[model samples]
Target: MGAVVLIATLDTKGPEVAYLRDRLASLGVDTFVIDSGILGEPVDITPDISHGELARRGGMTLDELQHAGTRGRAVEIMRTLVTDLVREKFALGEVVGGISVGGVGSVMGAAAIQVLPVGVPKIVVAPTASGHHEFAPYVGTKDVMVVHSIVDILGLNPISTTVFDNVAAAMLGMLRAGHPLGPPSADTRYVATTMLGNTTHAVEAMKARLAELGYETVVFHSNGVGGPAMEELAAAGQFVGVIDYTTNEITDPLTGGIHNGGPNRLRVVGELGLPQVVVPGCIDFSVFAAGQIPSALAGRPVYDHNPEYALVRTPEDEMRQIGRIFADRLNSATGPVRVVVPTRGLSIPSTPDGPFWNPAADAAFLEEVRANIRPDIPVETIDLHINDPELGRHVAELFSTILDSTRPKEALA
Candidate 1:
């Protein structure tokens, strides 16, 4: 069995790290401890991978880092070094699981473990994990388990010991019974797709049709994180094509909606030269929390998705801007790409007779897209609602045609 890796800032968290290491040892588990502390000497224990070695890996020394001016810069250096170390160890099969204790340790440890594949066990024990801090930085697109320490990790105490003991036990259990990720199947061709509540029926229908066409479908919620996560997996060579059924994340960055997918949202699969079918699914609106709509958009049509979320319709000008953004991103595609638009509506609330019914705004998007998009890329329009099953099946067939044409002759067999 491989050893479990423990990470901590040894100057402050040494005792807790030692206690957890000892507990794991008592349970017959081997461990390698990494000290990420920068300023002071390690307290109460020695680390297998000292902060000096970590800094040298980044072409710097402890003296240099101690005077790095800002704590943020020092932490950034250590984060990069530790992340590389953990990734190397995991690649070499030297570590089976990883745990980090305390606040700074949690951030560095989570960054390190994020490089590991999905099945590896990674845990972060920190007071910040207790529902108070935003978890996106720690959890980001990975299967990291964050446990609240309950008490500050200054030293071993009743509460701290219980948390460490439970964490050790949980790590051991995961190591013993967790399923290891194996190589992808040679016979299966996987396709990645995105979806939202507004485009559920369309995505489901596409998934079913893709399955019938002998392709496995991996569906990702097109919320802020899910789209990027899907892109990450796609860049990892996990899928042959993408059915981007819901692209609302594209509008979030423009409107300051909560589902912002950042700048690289729609560019990954295209950059990888994978055949992709794009849709303007859910582009008719931007979502905001209740009572949080921007003052500029307050008077526009709003649909209360729930008490927590309000969907504000995208005005014509914004839609036109979104269309230009879409065209720009899609124009750079390195492989076969197709854009499909649902003329009747882009979301349930935007359908005819619905609260956000605005054909002119939808038309504005289509018009801008056609005007600016690369002339080589085909733009197909369907006179159907975005959720219509027939539209989904049609896109699936369209994707199949593109995939078949682009696939190597050997792959076609």
Candidate 2:
């Protein structure tokens, strides 16, 4: 690892930024401090992107971009510039690790670093870490470490110095630890798999089978964050294939369930064009806020596994929407794709005598998918239940076939 770049708004936090730069020097590492503040002149910066370039990229004059802006707007503009600059530096292998310091400013700068490929040491020392729930998840997903600045960023206090010094030491240690993007291995190709508590057995089976074929499997919980994080990894080209076992979150999202997958859930398969085999594994129910269940559905069927999780039978109408959404996302694919439907039952709760065991709803969902999906796309419907060993085997076979089919044939050139 070469010199670690210390990125911050050196205009306002000059003293604090200087401490971090000096601390890195003490540890026998070179440091480049870049100033991103557009309001005032920078105190001390080695390789600075001037206010003029920031304003030019931001489409505003330096004075206008600074004076007309609140802290948030300034942060947003700075973030855009920083994201572009950091990506460029990373590609050139000039930056080993990145550290940012500030309250609002730190979040913006850290966010830019977060956009960098994972495994690079990313640290943010911010006073707002305690209440930053929204930004925290993005940081965690990207493996960016956030350290709480004990005192405010107004000036350097004892606590502030201690915290910043520790952060500097940690960053130094991370840079020295290993090179970013470690030595390549022939046997390991990361495979991301989605699973829920109900679908864990099938996923485990599939993972074991995939491992036999010489691929590592990363299992993601089908909760809100898990699915998105998996897609993120896929977009980064880290995963070779995806076995999406638990499509339950899409049901939650469509039927106003509490655990919706948002708009990005199934889009990654289309965007990245990775070999994917999806199933209607958990589309049997619509999760919702306990009190939000409709009057018609209030007593039809309900199961409360815990305070945070409750299952309600999905109606026939809701299933049709789920099918359309599923088919629509799948149809947009330019890559190899497969949709598997377990006709007998999609989840444990959808079996006979279970609370959400409604075949009509499941049938309606599948029918809509069959009716709307592109003819070129393959939709496989199996007779076994979702948890069936045979169903797991079928999933493995489809993924294996699709992945094998995608490998480039040799000696054509």
- My TM-score estimates for the predictions, one after another, are 0.94, 0.83
Model 2 TM-score relative to the real fold: 0.83
Best by TM-score: 1
Tens digits of per-residue lDDT for model 2, 302-350: 8775676777877888889989988988887778888899888887777
Off by over 4 Å in 1: 408-413
Model 1 residue 322 CA deviation in Å: 1.7
Off by over 4 Å in 2: 10-12, 38-47, 50-52, 67-74, 136-140, 182-184, 187-190, 248-262, 284-316, 344-348, 385-390, 406-413
- Model 2 poorest ten-residue lDDT run: 132-141
Report per-prediction Cα RMSD to one decimal. 2.0, 4.0
Residue 286, model 2, lDDT: 67
Clashes of each: 0, 2
